[model samples]
Target chain A: MTGRLGFWLAHLFVLAYCGVLLAGFVVQFGADELPCPLCILQRQAMILVMCGPLYIIGRARRGDVTLADYTMGYGMSIVAAVVGAGVAARQILLHIVPPDPGYGSAVLGLHLYTWSFITFCVVLVFCGVSLIFGRELVPRGVRFGWASKVVCGLFLVIVAANLVAVFFELGFHWFLPPDPTRYETFHGLPLLGAAAMSGGAVG
Target chain B: MAILIFAVLLLAGWLTVRGSRRATVLVVWTVALCAVLAVFNHHMAAKLSLNF
Candidate 1:
C-alpha cells in the first residue's frame, strides 16, 4: 500500500479504537461503575496510544507521512502499549492468585482488565511490526483533509471528557478514593462544570 | 496527575494545529507526553502494589 493509504488506515484504526473505548466508558459510567486509580492509569495509557496516531494526523496536516514520522509515531505507540500491558497484567495478577471478585462486570468470561491486557499486548505487537516496515510508508506532502479534521476533533473531545471525568472523581485536591463506587461531587453537583461556585473545594 | 497529562495533551493538540512550522515540536511534545504517562503508570502500579 502507498504511504498515503497507510496513513489513512492507521489514523482510522486509532480513531475507531478510541470510539470503542469511549463507548466502554459510557457503559461504565452509565452503570455507575466508578473507575479505580488503576483503571484511570490504564485509560491514560490508552490516551497515549491514541496520541501516536493523533500526532500523525496533526503532522499530516502540513505534509505527507515520512519514515521518521512513522518511526516516532509507532515507537511512541509501542512503548505506551507495552506500559499499558504491564499495568493490565498487574491488575490481572492481583485478582487471579487471590481470586478476588474483580472490578467491573465480566465480558465473555474475562474481566475488562484482562481484556485490556490482551488489547495492549496486541497493540504493542502491531505497532512494533509496523515500525519494521516504516520505510514502505513514505511521507508525501499532503494537506489536512476533512476526515483528518474529524478524527482529530473527536479525539480532542474524548480527551477533554476524560479530563473532566478525572477532575470530578479526584478534584483539584487530588483526593483519590481507594475504592470509588460513584463520582464525588457537592450534593451531586457537577464540580467540573462550575468551578467558581465551589472555590477551595477539594474532592 | 491525570489533570496535568490532559493539560499537556491539549497543549500538544493546539501546537499540532496552530504552531507555525511546528511539526518537529509537535512530535517531540507527544513523545515526551507518552514517556511521562508510561512512567506514571509504573509508579501508580507500584504504589497500589498490584504485584507484578
Candidate 2:
C-alpha cells in the first residue's frame, strides 16, 4: 500500500477505536465502580495507539518529521506494544483463573474486565504491526534493533485463526442474549406522534 | 456472542470510516440504548428500594 493509504487506515482505526472506548468508559463510569488496574493499562495502550497517528499527522502538518520526533514516536510504539502485551497476558490469566468475578452479568452485557483484555490484545497487535512499517529505520550506527519478526508473525497467525473461529461460531448461531423491550417509545402514545418523532429519528 | 458485535461493528464509526454514508446512525442508536438503560436504571433502583 501507498504510505498515504496506510496512514489513513491507521488514523481511521485508532480514531474509531478511541471513540468506542470512550463511549464505553462513559457508560461504565455513569453506572458502576472505578475501573480495574487492567482497564487503566488498556487505556494506556489506547493512548499509545492514538499517539502514533497523531504524531504522524502532527509532523506532516508541521511540514516534516524531525529526527528526534521520529525516533521518539517509534520508541513509544515499541514500548507500548510490550506493555500492552503484558497487560493482555495479565487479563488472560484472570480470564482463565478467575481472579475477579466479572463486574456485570456476562450474559446480559459486555464485561469490562473481558473488554480490557481484548482491547489490550488489539493494541498490542496494532502497535506491533505498525512498527513493521519501518518509518523510522535508523542509520547504521543509530539502529537500535528491529521488531521481532517471528513473534509478530505468530501473533498475526493466532489472531487470524481466532477470527475464523468467530465465523464458525456465527455459522452455528451462538449469540449473546439481549433483553426484551416493552415500551416502544417512538411508536407509542399520543405524546410520541410519528410527526414529532420523525424529526427526532432524523436528528 | 460479543464476537458478533465485533464482527458487525457495534459502533457505526467503524462503518463510517469504512465509507458508510450515514455512520452517525450509530450515535443515535447508542444514545437510545443509553436512554433506555438510564430510565430502567431509575425504575429498577426504585423497585428494589420498595422491596427492601
Candidate 3:
C-alpha cells in the first residue's frame, strides 16, 4: 500500500468515526437516554482513537508522510481501541445477569456499548491490516482537498458538541454520577445542592 | 472536568488539522494519555460490581 493510499484510507477512517459519534448522539437525544460515566469514557476513547487518523491526514498534507507516521497512527488507534473495548466490556459484564435488563435501551437488539465493543474490534483489525499492507513510500504534496476539510470540519463539530454535552451533563461538578438522569447544568442545580437534596453522595 | 479535557482535545484536533506536523504528533500522544487517565479516574471514582 502506497502512502497516498494510506492517506485516503485515513480519510475514510475519519468519516467512519464521525458516523459512529453521530449515531451515539442520535441515541442520546432521540431515545432520551443519558449516558452514564462509563459510556462517556467509551465515547472519549472513540474520539481518542479517531485522533490517530487525523494525525496521519495532517502529516500527509504537510508533504512529510513517513512509515513511522503510519506506524504511530495505527499504534495510537490500537491502544485507544483496546481501552475502549475494555470499558465497553466492563459495562456489558455489569448487566450480564439473566434477570438484569441491561442499561439504557438496546439498538438493533444490542446495547450501545456492545456496538462500541464491536466497532473497536473492527478498528483493531482495520489498523492491523493497513499496517501490514501500507509499506510503500508516500509521495509528497498530497492535496488537502475540500472533501478532507469537510470531513475534518464535521469531526470538529462533533467534538465541540461533545464538549457542550459533557459540560451540561456535569454542570459545575468535577465528576458525573455513575448513572446520570438529567443535565445538571441545564437544571441549574449545583452539584452539592443536588446531592444534599437527594441525600446521595456526590458522584 | 471532562468538559475541560474535551475542550483541550478539541483544540489539539483543530491545531492538528491546520497542517502542523508537530501539533499532530503532540495531539496524538496527548489524547492517548488523556484517554488512559480519564478511564483510570472513572474506575477509581465510580462504584462498580466487578471482581477480577
Candidate 4:
C-alpha cells in the first residue's frame, strides 16, 4: 500500500461513511421516523467524523501533505468515532430494558441506534488501522484526483443537509426539543399525513 | 442547542480551513467529546433541569 493509495483510501472511506449516514436519513424520512434528540446528536457525530476527510482533502489540495497532517486527521476521526459510539451506546441502554419498547423501526432486523453503534465501532477499527499503518497514508504531493473532488462535493452536500435538517427539526436559534417528533415548519399546523408519520413509534 | 451545535461545527470547519493543524484537531476532538457527554446525559439533565 503506497502513501498515495492510503490517502485516497482514507478519503474514500470517509465519503462512503457519509453516504451511509445519508442513506439512513433517507430511510428515517421515508419511513416517517422522527429522530430523537440522541439520534440528532449521533448525526452530529457523523458530521464530526466526516470532517476529518474534508480536512485531509483541504490540506492535500494546498500541497501540505505530511506525517503530522495525516496524524491529525486520523486522531480527529478516531476521537469522533469513539464519542459517537458512546452516544449510540447511551441510546441503546435507554431502550434495552423492559417497558421501554426499544428504538424506532428496525433496519435489516436491527434498530437504527443499534446500527449507529455498529457503524461507530467499525469507524473506530478503521481509524485505528489507518493510524497504525500511517506510513502509507502520508501525501506524496500528487495532484488531487477527480474522485477526491467528488467526495469533497459530497461532503459539502451532506453538511448542508445536516444544517437544513436541524433547522427544520429544532427551531432557528434555540427551542430544541428533548425528543423531537415534528418538523419546526409544521409546528403549528394541523396534523397532516406526513406529520402523522413524524410522530415515530418510540415515545 | 441544535443551532449551537451547528455553530460549533461551522467554527470547527472554518478553523480546519484556516487555523493551524493542532488547533483544528483540538477543536474537533473537544466538540465530539463534549457531544458524547451531553448526549449520554441529555435525558437525565432534562429531567433535572428547570430550563432545557
Candidate 5:
C-alpha cells in the first residue's frame, strides 16, 4: 500500500485499461458492430483515464516520484471516469425500456455500455483507494522494467490503432453517425469498398 | 473532427510518457475540452430516445 508499490501497481492498471480497450475492439470486429458516437466518446474517456497512470509511470521512471504526481495522476483518472460513467449511464438508460435490446450484442449477459459503466465505477473506487493508501514517497532511482516497457509500448500501439480506426470511422466527416454502419474512409478503397458497402447496407 | 481529437490525445499521452509535463497537461486539457464539446454536439445532432 506504500506509494512505491502503488506506483508499480499503476503500470498493471494501465495494462488492464489496455485490455479493456482491446476487448472493445475485439467486439467491434468479432461481432461486426460499429460503435455509435456515444460509444466512441466512452472509449475516448477511457483512453484519457489511462493517460493519468502513464503520467505517473513517466514521473517514477525519472526517480522523482512525489505526492503531486500521484494526486495529478489519480485526479485526472477520476475526472475521466466520471465523464465516461455518465456517457455509459446515458446509453444504458436509452435502452432500459422493455422490448428494447441494447446496442450491439451482449458480452457475458451485459451490454458493452453497461460493462463500461461498471468499469468506470471500478476506476473511481480504485483511484480513491489508491490515493488514500498510496501516500508514502517512493525512493529515488526507479526505472522502467521490461514488463513496464512492454505495457507502455502496448498502450502506445492501442492509441495509434484508435487513431486509425477512428479516422476510418469518421472519414471525411467531423462526426460519426448516431449509428455508425461503415468505415467512411474505406468507402472508396477498392479492397475495402465492398466491405464498406455491405456495412452501409446494414444501416 | 474525432480523428483530430484522438490524434491530439495520442500526442498528449506520448508527451506525458516522454516526461514533458507542462506540454502534456496543456494538451490533455485541450483534448478534454474538445471532447466535451464534441459530445454536446453529438447530442444536439442525434435524435435520442430519452425523454429527459
Candidate 6:
C-alpha cells in the first residue's frame, strides 16, 4: 500500500465515503434544514475521515518523511474510519428493518428505494478498507512510533465513546434538539490545522 | 472559497513535494475535495433559491 495506486485509491475511497454521507442527509431528510441526532453523528464521522488527507499536507510541509510519522497517524485514521463505517452500517440496517423507531422516528421522507441506506453501507465499506491499510502501513519492526499509537489510541477511544453514546441516545430517543450549538462541538474541532499534521505520518 | 483554495494549494504542494506514492492520493483527494465543495455550494445555492 506504499505506491501511487494505493495512495490515490485510499483517498478516492475516503472521499467517496464522505460524499455518500453528504448525500444521505439530503435523501433521508428532504429539504429540511435540521439534522437528527444520528444524522449529525454521521456528518461528524465524515469530517473526521477527511482529516486524514488534509493532515497529509501538514506532514508534507514539515518534510517529516519518516516511518514514524506514518505509523503514529495510523491508529487515529483507523478509528475514525471504523466509526464512520459503523454509523453507515447502522443506518443501512435501519433502512432494511426499520422497526418501531426504537426512539427517534427518523425524519420521514420518501424512501428513495434505499439509496441513502445503500450509500451509508458503501461509505462504511470504504472506511473499512481505509482502516485496513492505515492500521498496517508501517512495518512491524518500527517500534519507535509506538507512543504515538498509545496517545492517539487514547484520543480515539474517547472520541469513539462519544460517538457511541451519541448514536445510542439517538437510537433510544434521548436526543437534544437540532441546534447549531451541538453541531460545532462534534463537527468543528479544527481537524485541518496542526492536529492533522501530527496525526498523519509523512506521505 | 478562499479557504478551500488554500487547502487545495497546500494539498497539491504537498503531493508535489512527496513526489511518489503520496502524490496520486493527495491529488485525487484535492480533486475530490474540490468536487465535493462544488456540489455542496450548488446544493446550497439551489436550496437558497427555492427558499427565497
TM-score of candidate 3 against the unseen true structure: 0.86
**Interface C-alpha RMSD per candidate, 1 decimal:** 2.8, 10.5, 1.7, 3.0, 1.6, 12.0
lDDT of 3 by residue, B1-52 (tens): 6777787778767876776666455755576556557655567556764455
- Winner by TM-score: 5
Tens-digit lDDT track for model 1 on A1-203?
Answer: 46676677677767766875786687677777877766777777777777676666667766565677667667767877887787787777667865578877887898878878888887877776677666766545556788777877777778788788878876654545657765565436665457755664764
Cα-lDDT of candidate 3: 0.80
Off by more than 4 A, model 4: A172-175, A189-203, B14-25, B28-36, B47-52
Docking class of 5: medium
Q: Write the per-residue lDDT of candidate 5 for residues A69-181, one digit (tens) a residue.
A: 77888888898898889888888988899899889999899999999999999999999888876666332446766866787789889989988988878888877788888
Q: Using TM-score as the measure, what is the rank order of every candidate, best first?
A: 5, 3, 4, 1, 2, 6
| Top-down DockQ ranking | 5, 3, 1, 4, 2, 6
TM-score of chain B of each: 0.51, 0.49, 0.54, 0.53, 0.53, 0.51
**Residue-level lDDT tens digits of model 4 in A50-79:** 777667666776675788877777777787
> Which candidate ranks first by DockQ, i.e. highest?
5
Every model's DockQ: 0.38, 0.06, 0.57, 0.33, 0.59, 0.03
Model 6 C-alpha lDDT per residue in residues B1-52, reported as the tens digit of each score: 2223224433443343233355464455446345434533443354333232
Candidate lDDT scores, in order, read 0.69, 0.42, 0.80, 0.72, 0.80, 0.43
Q: At residue A56, what lDDT does model 5 achieve?
A: 82
lDDT value, residue A31 of candidate 3: 90
What C-alpha root-mean-square deviation, in Å, does candidate 6 show against the real structure? 18.5
- Of 3 and 6, the candidate ahead on lDDT is 3
User: Which residue runs does candidate 6 get wrong by more than 4 Å?
Assistant: A24-30, A85-175, A178-203, B1-52
Q: List the residue pairs that clash in candidate 3.
A: none
TM-score of each: 0.80, 0.42, 0.86, 0.82, 0.88, 0.38
Which tens-of-lDDT digit does each residue in B1-52 have in candidate 2?
3233233222322222222222243343234333323433343354333332
